[model samples]
Target: MTAKAKYQEVLDLGASLNIQNGDVKEENGTLKVWGTANTPYEKNLIWDKIKAIGGESPSDIMADIKVADNSVYHRHTVKSGETLGKIAIQYYGKASKYQDIFKANSDILKNPDVIHPDQELIIPNA
Candidate 1:
């Protein structure tokens, strides 16, 4: 399965567990369930089942990419066939933002037309 698919699957499972905000706690490099809510006993049961299955917390399932100022900037390594336009679309969800990316990494990307593999490009916030 694709990485995105796997991530979604894990998120779905976590949501299925019906873990409340209070139940999830980050402790000693792992997320553990601490307490039970009064209203939803069924959610606790689901959480128990999830724990039995060795399921991790939603945060544990997420990718550990660095975020700056509440925005995650993508560090894209240029591929042989990839263009700035493609990279912009991939990162910013729009090809028009190519100039934005170009402007951000002007030092590295001397020429917008010439990009090679392993050339790290900073995809700025859209």
Candidate 2:
């Protein structure tokens, strides 16, 4: 397959993740991808998709995935049944740190107790 065609899914995956500064180039039977992911988790999601398409390690693709917020451990997309304290415990190992997450996401989150599914939240650096 042409490099473009071979990595189409990876490109699409990057778009779905809202990658910033995304660039794609196909040359000499290889695809080069560059983008800044919002978080390490987002970067991993892209790599996971790449490996799933090209096996454990794919030589056909080169990806430069930079994290937008290197200080934060991860960017978490909220799910049903997830609370700020629950998320805090997952990242900070202390449910009390929910206030930190609440302050970090105050732009979209009005209350610490409320978060909806698919709402992206930044897990700030400890």
The CA lDDT of each predicted structure is: 0.55, 0.88
lDDT of 1 at 5: 42
Residue-level lDDT tens digits of model 2 in 94-125:
99999999998899999887799999998887
The stretch of ten residues in a row with the least summed lDDT in candidate 2 is: 39-48
CA shift at 37, candidate 2, in angstroms? 0.5
16-123: candidate 1 lDDT, tens digit per residue = 644344234344444443332222323334454444444555443222212222232556778889999998877656888888888988998788878889998777
TM-score of each: 0.47, 0.65
Clashes of 2: 0
Cα lDDT of model 1 overall?
0.55
Residue pairs in clash, model 2: none
**What TM value does model 2 have?**
0.65
